[model samples]
Target chain A: MRFLLLVIGILYITPVLALSPPTGRVLLTLTGSITETNAGHTAKLDRKMLNALPRYSITTKNPWVHQAHKYSGFSAVDLLKLTGGKGDLLRITALNKYVIEIPITDFTKRGAIFAMRKDSHPMSVRELGPILVMYPFDDDPKLKNETYYWRSIWQISTIEVLTSPSKE
Target chain B: MVKWFRKWLPTSKLQHWYVYGLLSLIVTITLLASSILLYSYNGNQATKQRIYEDSLWNALQFQLQSYRFLNYLVQIDKKDLPLNGAAYTQYDLLMSRVDLLRSGEVGYLIRGLTGGRTVRLLNIITGELELISLNLSKIEEGDLSYLQDMTTRLKQLDNQVNEFTILVSKGTNLYIARQRRALGENLENVRILMMCFLASLFVLCCCIAKGFSVFKINQRNNKQLLIDIQNIHEEKAKILTLVAQEARPQIQALLGVPCDNTESSNSIKESANELLHTINMFTDLALIDIKKLSLDITTESLQKNLDDYVQIFSSKLQRKGVTLVSYIDPALPDVIGLDFKRLKEIILELLLNAIKHTPEGSISINVRPSSLTPTQQPLNLENRRIGILQIAIKDTGFGLEHAIQDTLRASPTTQDNQPLILQNNIGLGLSLCYRLVHLMRGEIHFSSEATSGTEFWVDIPYEVSQSSPENISLYSCPDPKRALIFTTDNHLANALRLQLSSFNIEANRYLEGPYYDDEDLDLVIIMDSNLISPEIESNIKQWQKNGTFVLYDHQLTKDVQNKAYAAKAQSLSFPLTQSRLNGLIMDAFKTD
Candidate 1:
């Protein structure tokens, strides 16, 4: 009984530390180039060019989804510019070794983005943060299927704009 | 008054106030806690919901940014460069941030970032991304309508998010208002309950105050009653003292002149007779009150004590022309408290008055002794012998006025129906006699006329008993002719010797001393013996055993009486009057 009470006391006080915002470290590493699709063309952007664009969010549902969830991210075109990429097709690889190809023109879609954070915090590797492709499946039922959901890669390690696209 | 009652209330009530205060504190604490909890919960829920909405918003924004970047990549065609360079690395990091937002990694940042319209915009952006990812390489130049259509959808989505946010804000305001009203009602109920408890407590205090006031008033009234009783006692004491002081001297004067002077018997007798006349006058006044008085029957001793009263009065009555004749019935015992002496004096005074008034008639007093006749049959043996004494006094003189005669007849009917008609006018003398008789536990009756005098009768009841002869000695006499002479005064002894000369007594006298020898003493007459010695008494006893007659003075000590009885001597008290002396000598000789 005494031990149980002690456990409850600790549990009751644990939220104080857990509920506070994380401080001190901001960790994100990207080692490959990115591409942008803007005004029906593939374009390359530097970090300064990407930084100059207004920061914003779009909260909505999507349709090419499996496990439907609300998603938040920057547009893929914007990220590619920031990474200095200019190619017709972008090759992306997840830390889990999954790969996908996206055409540069696809990045210019209205609800599409290359997101870096969710709810103001970096995502864990298992949570598919630091690099991932996502769609708001909760907003569009059409996106909550295997086709669209599979293309949204998580644990991404690299994105390279390639001209010699054998598969594409 | 309310304040005073509050003072009397128990400390418990004060403690109750503190309890109420504590309850108020608890309620306030609860309200504060509830308000804080409501604020926190609303904040938490709003933050969570906003995060979900804003995540969609941010994901859409990221999609827009990523699309532009991808377009730039295609336009620039810089695929050969490493993104790790300062400019490229920064762009890669920005791309990573966009990826994290799309994956919902910074979900908390989405709070306040987007709403319903933004959520739709996110859907449009995600759809566009999906379409481009799949079919951008397949689109011909004429498919430009697709990009235009996607842009139109994105703008519509943004508008929808705004509409949703407005609806949520209106809902939050309603929730807050309802919560505030609930809190207010809870506080109001607690306040009302506290006030009711205090009011009831105050009423209880009032009851206690009323009870205490009643007790205090009763105590005050009791104290006043005690004071009143004390005052009444003091007043009675004063009245008694006044009565004693005013009446004692007068009553004492009525008792008589002192009998201390013994010069001549005649002179003494004459003085006594004079005192009797004054008593007679007092008795006359007492009777005058009776003649006109209306009162119930009263006892004689209560009127005045007469055993010691008449001797002094009778002497005075003898000097007057009237001779007081008395015919007393020896059978009646004295139970009536009529002062016998006082009654006699009053009667003698009446006789004198009758003698003076008529100048030549006799006043004969005949008293018929009364006895109890059982009105109901004898209830007990003791009551069968109960006796009564009645007395009547009749006078011969010039008779009564007719008016007085009628009044006498109307004197009030007796239970026995005895007629009493007055023969003379009602005067001080007649009235006095009537009252005196009435005082004897008896009623008065008169029979009179203008020519013949009046007669008065009194009735009383008493237990009559015989004078037992226990005082007479029963002794064996060898000679039956002895005479006994008893005298205590020396002068009386000489007179007794002369008085006994005619009798053949062996005359012996002892002087008042212990020197006399008792050896030859027989037929002993103790005259003037004082301090009789035991040796003399022993010798007298020897003689008495040899059949000598023994008599003693009244002054003999009680020890002598015991001694005489031990010796079987006949003892009697001494100094008999002339008539009694002669009678005693004759009885003694006859007994011998």
Candidate 2:
């Protein structure tokens, strides 16, 4: 009876220790202060894994388009939850090596999202896709300001959660 | 070809008005054409400017829409709304805006302004929107991390697009400025063209005014010329009438007497005839010179006329003791185109010159077909086959003096320089002859030596006529009869005796007394019937009853005329011609 209980405990803890690796080509990677990861010290995700997060749809205008467009993707809060990341700031990188930093509250309080599909279609790299950051500028008029507009990143390849300098 | 061209050209009389009207029409047409061209050019430029401005405005609208849509998308992302059909619709609308900005005329304008960078910006924006659209599923699942990054890139794109819009506005404004400058230049050109047209019009008006003045002057001159010509014609006609009517009759009277029996009488008669012929020739020449008369050309016997002329002057030659010789070619045509009156004057002039100059020598006149040297022939008569009758009159006398020859060689305009004696003699005669010959299309040449002789030759063209001509000569008295003349004038009695002797008639003259006692007389001629008394008249009647015919002169009293008529006598007028005297004598003898 003792052996069976130990076996059940090990089985329950093994999943927490070893996360399932990405089944397809990795589309995004999260590092630094991330608790849940499929690779060591980092969380690697494919298109399928990214789709498994809590979904959101944003209908808003951006500097790149003339009208409001519907963007379907996971909220940054849910993506953070999936990676088990805790940070005061988040640094994002694009495929072109372009980088930008944003406050963690922009994702948690503002409900910003990483869009993977536009108009119900998956975006290609040529479309600045696989990932794009979109603020809910239509819902919160404050997000339509320049500060929030600059925070919205496109063609995202990686994210790094970092603690505040004071906390370090 | 010249005549055809002249037919289309305006005559001198109408040229002024025609040229003025043509110049005015040309100026007006040029003005109209220039105005039309200016208007069309301005209209085309305006159209082109409008097109450029329209394209600029379109580009501006597209850029504005792009910014607005971008703002909307930011709001939607911030709200974290569900991916819905409305959002996709907005996205599509934004994409279409970018597409419009990248192509067509708007694209070209933007590209020109941005150095081709505007297209790249547009492409970037489109790519970003498409990427966002492709990642819609991930974005809808609460993955909002990429929003900040996309917003920053889009902000940069928006800045670039805004710059493109500014460039477009500036380019359109610059185009408008350039077009305005071009328009001003066009207006200036129109002003200059208008000024040129006005100046041309002014010049044309001046020309027309000058032309009118010239035309008026010409008309005045023409009127004056016509009046002058009319005066000349009247004067020529008057002179011609005087010679024909008065002088000719008087000269005929002088030539009526038979003066061959005495040298002095013969010389006096020849001098009177020569003077009369010279006067007639001078008057005719004056008429011809003024173009008031034409030579009356006719087919006549030149030889016959020449013979008559020589015969009339034969006694003058005899008195001068000069032998006269003449020749006529048999090969010459029977009749030729000759102005008989003019030819007579020319021949007589030559003969008189010959007789006057040849004091103690001979004169020879010859007529024949001329083999003229090329230099002697008139150019116009070169190809003609008609007979060239050359008449040459040569005289053995004092040849022309050097001074006289020089005077003759001088032009008629310089005739005043000639000595008065020469001008009154040979100068006047030769000039007259020259003019007359030229009028007949003939040429005359002369050669002379001092104290030797002078020879004159004339070559005249003549047309042959088909008809034969009759010969002209003096009439001869048939028979001679005895007559007694009673005249108070001694000179008249002597002239009558001399005239009667030439006809083979015997005449007894009594100037101061009259006797009708001659029984052998066939006729008695009384010079004046008034001189006869009743006793004499009775005696004449007794004589007439004894078969003697009586003749009375003119200027008789009516009673005397009746007495003479009753006595069966005839009356003769004074100053009788030779033919008239011969006719009277023949009539009287026939009656006897």
Candidate 3:
């Protein structure tokens, strides 16, 4: 009976461990001071891997939108937990070479998200999609100014954690 | 200018003007306060509107930026560049900003500015965003053909958003300008209200000052008037004192004379007494003029007083050959509230006028109870009996001329014309008579015909006195006496002889030039003498020594009466009464 109980426990724990290894092409990369990784010293995530980290949906207006649209993603804090990323500042880079520096505290405080889908659909490259860094601008009045809006990077490619303060 | 102002200015009417001004001030203040409150409320609403408009403008700016970014993404995709996830994210962001602008405070402000134009723009933008979003999936799959169509639609929306933003900005500026102008007008109204309040205060001060000045002037005038009245009173008192002091001696001498029954002697005495009474009435002229002569009303015989007054003119009437007729109503009260002295003067004045004017016709006086003249009756006597005693004096003489009659009826204040009326010798006595009648609350009427006569009727109000008349009979001498009389005047000597004969006393008259001794004389009578010579005085003494009684008529000065009394003779005044003569005869006979 102890053997049967051990098998059931293994069945429940297997799927969770299986979700940590990315099978599709890597869309997001996390580097520096990381404990968990899908490959080597850095943590790299595909769409399916990022989705497996606690999903949430939000509707908000931003500087780039004509109407409020629904964005489905995992919170930045959840993604950091999945990669075991530890840092005071995050340097994010988009595919178009657009870069922004954000405090790591903003991830938890402002409900910052790594958006994978807009209006319930997966984002394409031409749509500034695949991954986007978004803050809930409409929900929080303090995040509505230019500082937070500029920090919300679109078409994000990589996140580098740094313990040092940014020059800007 | 001063006279015109005096005529037109509301001098004593300031209170009414002040009340009206105060009421208007209160109403104006209330109106101004209410206007200020309403203006402040309007200003608050304007501020709220401006805040809403500013929020709407910020929303439009955001929507424009989102649309521009979407267009940039589409351009990048058409250039065969890797957009990554930019196109879909930009499209979603543009849609979200457009959705926010369509509702909430921004929506409300846009709707207020262009009615439904903003909503229509929003609908068009929304429809364009939905179409672009649908094609977003196709473009992501490496399909670059839809990029041009999406860019064209986004460019159109950008143009429309820019136009709507300008419209909203212009509309907001105009609204702000209108609000500013309204606030300025409200301030101007407040300034006008302040000026009006100051003006009202100025007018109220002027009215109060004017009223105070008028009150001061009235007080000064009243003080001056009081001083003038006091001076007039002092002057009147002095004149009355002079008249009373000068006329007292003559009046006392005349009152001492005894009255006799003989017509000629009685008329002489009556005329003298009337002259004294006239002077006494003249002394009281000031009192009568001021209406201060109160009646000393008492029970007295009006008929008897009238008879005495009538007798004063009898000798003149006799000499003028005018017949005298008199009548008295027996039913009239024997005693009534008559100021006897004033009434006697009134009768005497009328009688003298009649005697002076008549040539040969008869003069008559009639007394009776009669109705008061229409003007003389008091208004409040509806339930009470008002007794009026009418004394009418009718004379057949050259009637009073029209002008003289007018002067008689004229008010006494017209003293300048009084002397003119008296120039005819008729109005002086009648004027005096008229004043006396009026003083007694009486009315006098005169009727005349040019060639015939004039008549005066005086009606006086009286209260009947509750007293009976006294009856007194004349006394006669018990024995006839042989008496000697001495006088300087023939009329007086003859009057004395006639009066002696009525008492059956045989008397012989001696003129002033003679002296005689009679052994059979029982009494000696001296009529009147200012001074007696030593010879006449000795003769009076010799008659006293011969057991004869002497009686002297003292009509001269007080010194002459002292001399007569020093001679040890009984002296009597002129015009002796029957009772006095009877008493004298009884004393003389008792000595015998």
Candidate 4:
């Protein structure tokens, strides 16, 4: 039993992940320059699959929201880890076809998150959900700017990591 | 402005307004620095907002979402496919775009871009989009017609959104252009302000640097000037020494070996002697002024020196057709320790000064005690006498100008290089005399009565003298007798009485207020005839009857003299000498 507990502890401390294939409807796709694959060099994530990972909440205000709301989501850094994504730049696409390219540092350095729920309730498609790329604006004054605002694309459908044109 | 300020400011302003200028410069620099900081702060805030560009992007995204949704609806109708999750996603994405444009900061930007028309247009579009969204599930199974109608409506909505986006793009472009122009103007202002501030700072620094150099140069020049002045002073001393050491002795030796014994030869000798003396005095003056003159104080005959000066001046007076008379106090010491050369110079110069201006009238030099009468002075009849010896040179010349008189009357303030110029002819002589007298801690006083005469009396302290005339005359009189002086209490009478007392003729004095009425008075001398009242005249006549011989001053009138003869009183000259007074007394008591 002690040996089993130590193994679990080692698994928790290390960034070793064995993400299983999704059984629910896929809500997000990760392709290009990813190590882990559920469907041939791609990661198709379902809501339950993302939910199985650790959850996070960011209480922050934005232009789209009237007041600060506790947005429950998966951390962008943890999600990238689950997909085993690698690249300097992240190319994101929203359901509305509004696209933005951001540096990976926004996830690793600025603590960006993909919100699926607001105030403990799952958001509908019309409510800018499934995934909303958000920054904890109240945490860092630097992130509360137009550049970061434009980078926070909502209803995100896809994230493509571009290592290089030749690699793709 | 500077001229106006200068006109208003006091005359004694600093040579350069560096301090105030530096203060104003500091204030200006502070103001300019703060202005730049404030400008940068505002620019930072505008950069932070970046709201206009964000608003434009949001509007474009809203319009694009509308077209994309419309396109999807059209594709569904063309393909005759059942509307499913894909169809719902497109509708939801369009709804979210509309929501984003209709609410919050992006919504306000669209409203402003469309002149507030975005609100109504968005409301109608939102109603239509919501209607389609509500019936989207049903449309997925049965009717292509309803989907086609919704597609046309969404196309119309996309057109409206495109119009709003165009307006936003135009407004954002205009705002950005205006901001760029304003930024250019602000940058230009900052540039000009920076240039002005730097130029002023440069000028102030240059002025300070130049001021420092000028101050250093002036300091060097002043030091050089001091050295030059010292050189000039040394040169003057060398020249003075050359004249004193070489020229004066040559003149003296040339005089000693006479050429002819003629009047011209004698005159030349006299002139040579005068030149030697004048040169010596100037050398002495320099020494005395610098407080370097040392006296050869010695015990010498003060009376003999005085008599010698009197005799020499008397002969000079005779030749010049002027009289010189001297009256030495009979009670002064015969020997005293004093600087004889300086004393001789003082007397000779004073006499010469008087003779030069006198023209005709006599010059009288009187020597006496500066303080109490000879009898009242502290005398043990054996030891040395200590007193202030007053030597008064009274000339009957046309008196001095009141200005010169007042100056001489005031005691010497200091024994300095520049002696008091008592008069033009008096010149260095009397001035030198003033210095000499002060060197011995002496005082000089004078009085002038316009055309009457002037008297300069020098009173020197520390007179160390051996025998007084009063002591000498005590033996000169041979007998000590009693005499009554019926005289006014005047200085002249007091002096004469004191003289008589020195002659051992116990003299009693009387003024007009009271009479020394002694019935057995052998002899009576009346100094002032005006004091001879009727009762005094009767007593005088009685004294005559009792064989009491009497005398009166020669200055009395004929009427008083006749009365004096009736009262057996004789008339005699005033200022009687010691020998003359003794002779008169012996004659008066010959029968005894």
Among the numbered candidates, top DockQ falls to 4
Query: Scored by CA lDDT, what does every candidate get?
Result: 0.47, 0.68, 0.66, 0.70
Quote the chain B TM-score of every prediction.
0.28, 0.38, 0.39, 0.42
DockQ of each: 0.02, 0.01, 0.02, 0.46
* lDDT per residue (tens digit) for residues B87-199 in model 4: 78877877777777777776666676656766767777778778877668766765666876787777666666776777778888888888888778877777777777777
What CAPRI grade goes to candidate 3?
Answer: incorrect
- Candidate 3 docks with a DockQ of 0.02
Q: What lDDT tens digits, residue by residue, belong to model 1 across residues B433-503? A: 55545443445556775565666555543333233312112222234343333333333344445434434
In terms of lDDT, the poorest run of 10 residues in model 3 chain B is B413-422
lDDT tens readout by residue for model 3, B1-592: 9999677555555444555556666766776686678778876766566555654555565556655666575556355645565565566555545654655456566666766776676677667667768877877777878777877777777776776666667767777777779778877887777677677666656656765676677678879987786577557756876877777777667666776767666666666666666566555555654446666765676656665666566556656755454555555766666678778778777877777777765566767777653444332334433477788777778887777776666645333233343455554456566666766767778887767678889888765554554322333456777777765544344445655665567877765565464446677776545435677777777767777787764433354556643456676642243335556766766534
Residue A116's lDDT in candidate 3? 87
Interface RMSD of 4: 1.4
Encode model 2's per-residue lDDT on A82-147: one tens digit a residue.
877788788999754568988777777897888999988998654557788898887887775557
Please, what are the lDDT tens digits per residue for candidate 4 over residues A1-168?
Answer: 999999998877654234577898889998877778787567889999888778878899997766788888887667777877777678999876668987777777888878898899988788888888888999999886778988988888898987645445
- Among residues 3 or more apart in sequence or in different chains, the pairs in candidate 4 whose N, CA or C atoms overlap within 3 Å are B331-B470
Q: Best-fitting candidate, measured by lDDT? A: 4
TM-score against native, each model: 0.23, 0.32, 0.32, 0.47
Query: What is residue A112's positional error in candidate 4, in angstroms?
Result: 2.1
Model 2 residue runs over 4 Å out of place are: A1-168, B1-155, B181-185, B188-192, B195-199, B202-206, B213-217, B236-282, B289-291, B302-333, B342-592
* Leading candidate by TM-score: 4
